[model samples]
Target: MSKVDVYDVHLVETVASTTDVKPLPLATIDIRVPLPDELIHLSLEEQDSLERHIVRKMDRRLMPIIIVMFWLNILDRNSIANAKIAGLPKDLNMNNAQYNTCLLIFYVGYVITQLPSNAILPMVRPSIYIPLVTCAWGLMSMAQGFLHDFQSIMVVRFFIGVLEGPFFPGVIFLLSCWYKKEELIKRIAFLYAGNILSSCFGGLIAAGIIGGMEGVAGYAAWRWLFIIEGLVTVAVGILAMFLFPDYPRTTRWLTKEEGLFAEWRLSNEVAGIIDEDSSGIWWGVSEALRDPLTYLFTFMQMMLTTGQSFTYFLPSIIKTLGYNNTITLLLTAPPYAVAFLGSVALAYSSSKRKEFCMHICFPLTISVIGNILAMIVHGTGARYFAIFLMAFGVYVVYNVNYAWVSSSIPRPQAKRAASLAIINLMSGGATHFYTSYLFPDNDAPRYYMGGSALTVAVFLCAMTAITIRFYLARLNKKIDAAGGDAEAALRANKGHTETMKAFRYQLHWWTWPLPKALGTEVISIYHTSSKSADAAKIGKSNFIATSTEKWAEKHSRTLETILCTFFKNGTQLEEYILMLDVGGIMVYVEIPESALPPLPPGLITGNNFAPRESNTASKKEVLQMFKLKTDQKIKSWVEEVPMENCIEAVEKL
Candidate 1:
């Protein structure tokens, strides 16, 4: 009655010789059907995308506070060097040799407790821990003003060194936890710049305090410098208790959503970038110990810190140039000022470029050149240029090197913590022997002992930089190879969950996901039950268009292209799908009655699916859908299970 129209397509043939029409079977068993997209795992190109999603939201406020705190801390600790030039040695009655012993004793107490103190950091809040240490050191520094004899100076200095040892390493660890690995070097350099600025700040403070040579309440100007600066440090330390945030997860300053977001971002960033096998507390220590570069870093730090010991007496060294005490203190500012500006410039560029080795090496070479000039030059102007070079060269590498420490060991927070402690211990201990003897008032104008040692240290440090560069290059190559291997492995055992777990345990934490080459997916497979296996590898790729190299490449690949190409070539999407995670639910794509059968449900006819940019409604929708699907599957699966099988279901899930 209604034309009896057929909606289905059929192959028809007209009989040439007969009026009888044969009705052929409408469906054929041999008919080919496209596999349902539902049955086929739908993966997302999320390596770089996820990275950006996490990195974009990092809080920048902590950076300024941390930088300022460390800046003032270093300034106060090293200012004693400047005070000596303003006649602290004369007022304390410290002789040329007794003064050397005083410097030496400081390291004794400093070196012994470094490791122990660092171990205790996680147990106490940094806000409380750092400020308490600051208060203790402030008191010690204040007490330094009261020392009238060599023994008193020696005792006070030793205690000062002991308390100060934990501060730098503690700060480094805290920074590492908050920033992504790629973002860390620059931030670390910024914080370390405080050490550079301290040089200038110390000179300025000394110039103001000791310039007039007036006694404070019967105390010498040198004594007044310690008391006043110490009191200021104590007050700031108390304030920091209120200002400093706890760990990223517990920061009360941020909204609850913000805190969770921060943790999630870091987790995503670090997922494939680190060794899955190398997490937990013990793993950090083992990883740090196993890496030969850690010791090399130690050596680099030793050489650097040995040269830095000379920083304290720079004003005294300048005074030997025939300037009165006040002029010497004033003159100290220019070279140190040059250092602060130069280091910030170099550090900013170096971090921005993500080039650690060359940037650091350049400064070490410059430092060597500076020291050589200081020793060889006869003219006063040339010698002063040498000092400027010395200050600038040292500061440039100082921040870069600390960044190196944080970046090198990507786990068990303990390794980062321990290595930092070791660096400080070696630095402080080395200072005990090297810094005191070089600047004897006897050597005054030309500190041959000090100059020679600094020169040697600079040369050694340059060599150390070369070694580190070679090692990182090799390590980077290994990491690249591992990425390929990881992808291939993922493809070989698709749909298998246990294999993913094994893979996770075998890989390193900071190694990011492999690219679309050698069988790894260019897109991450959602709902695959193996996410945790590769979660440790998350931050392994370039996440931010602002920071990473592969951001554009990741963005250009569409979902349709990825699936069509993967199916056509059968090469497997090994690189992109870092892991498939099994969770509380699974998606079951539904097929409408009018849609094609034989093909599984939810098969799109067109190849038009594309990768979505981060923060898009599409991406958010996908995540939400996946979550809903997960919950639905879990509920259905549980509902079907018998009560007797409940334990088995829980175990399987």
Candidate 2:
């Protein structure tokens, strides 16, 4: 018979004989059927090729739409800043502080909606939720064009903030659902590149509208900017509802085999904990609140975001060089364009090296230098150079920091969603509430006070990132000491993703101990055997007995000496036989003779073995007697061995 037919008969016979016996629990049964060679034994090159294919497919389908959505998201949210330079504040009869209030009020709605929006994301279809919110915000943004006074603009801005609040955090959470941690940084940087590019392109678009559309429709150029951008945003939002893939497991675009492979890859990478169900927003919030790193990183993000708030007033900052509105708007694009390239390079390095802290710290340090230079330098050329440095530094830090948050909190999707939203919400508040006051109109043309505060914030951000790095290092050390068992780390982390035995936080630098601290090797064994032998000649019970006897024979000398020596001294010796199946091949493993406990008298040893006292009336009677004794011994061993340890051993097989 063919090997497949023989195994099929064995399985059927085993099940039929056990029909009247109590069924084992599903977890206790080894039900994995053999797979075809093509599925089970793929070459490394084949695996890599498949991975590349999946990545390319995902990138082609997902990235462009996501990037464009983010571009529209940023353009709508920050267009007010561009409009201000085009005489928006003057046209609306708004003063400097009122304009800042408008900025600050938007964040009030922004902060209020973040937690709920993120919490609701997993419960609703993202394709529907995200696009609906995008469309709502687009309408609100368009309403800005019709507003004639400060209060009306503030109302529209606030509603726009409320509707737009979910997009950033929602997208971050969505990306995490599809990509592994190692793949996340570059993807996030690419998504963030959209934000940077919008600053560049938003400027060009705003300038074009302001220059050409000023008198064409009898509406102010600033009004045309809102109407045109808002219409574009609404259209994209409508399109994205159809384009966006929801999640890897649920996405219909992939074939069945591809979907299973994708899920398996992710589950293995995450140690098999892929929590898709919502565990409740409050539960997620509670978990995040308990993690002290959440507070530290959130505050760090807030400070970093607060310091980089100059992007909102880039036109105003450039205008300090005494350029006209058109020239100033055009000039704003170059710094952000430069920063986009810098951000991509930094993100690539971070992803390649699998590091986070250094990527963040290095950039923030450069930003600190830029802030100081802007404060000390008087020349326009020197100041513009300073702007380039500041823009590159702050934005790269922003992109990588969010990636860090996602990697650091990878499980129990609810908590991850909560943590991301909370950090973003607070950062938004900081951006508008604190950073707004930093750049008062009175401090224009060299806002020394603003620069100094930003300098201090950037320095604190660096210090905080370093501190967080050290804290994770300490946790890693504890994990290493526990023999790299994630359970120990989980105990220490109170069941957070930080305890995921396989998860490691990226450090600022590669240290000698970091690799050992981050991960440990798990040794595995596999055994293969031919299955063409006749079942009667090589029966399961006889094979097990023969294997056990052969193993005992190999260690006979040590076993006999130990048992004999112990028995002579009026003591007993105990030995154990551990049975395991590796790769469908049965193995009988014995404890080392030296480590065995005292054995009982008359136990068989290779050097001194004798048949047990028995009277055989018939061959059947003697055979039955041998079987009963062997069964009893096996039963005793099963009763003594810990079930948990047995389960663990089986899992290793």
TM-score of each: 0.67, 0.72
Give per-residue lDDT, candidate 1, residue 244: 78
Checking candidate 2 for backbone clashes, the offending pairs are: 572-598, 572-599, 573-598, 573-599, 574-597, 574-598, 574-599
Question: Model 2: per-residue lDDT, tens digit, 201-235?
Answer: 98888888888888666889999999999999999
User: What are the per-residue Cα lDDT tens digits for candidate 1 across 1-653?
Assistant: 00001111111110001001211111100111332233223123332343345445444557776777777677767767777766777877877787667767777877877777776666568878888888888888899888787778888888988887777778888777777565776787778777777767777777888865467588788888888888888887888788777666677676554555455444444332321223445445554555576688889888888777677678777766778877887787788678777777876776554566677778878888888888888788888999988877877778777776676654446666766777767765755576667777777677788888988987788788888777655444333334324234433433111111101211111222212211223333322223323322332111112123443245432222111111212222232221112111111121222322232222222222223211112222333444665677632111357889989978986
* lDDT score, candidate 2: 0.68
Runs with alpha carbons beyond 4 Å of true place in candidate 1 = 1-60, 272-287, 480-653
Clashes of each: 39, 7
Whole-model lDDT for model 1 versus the true structure? 0.58
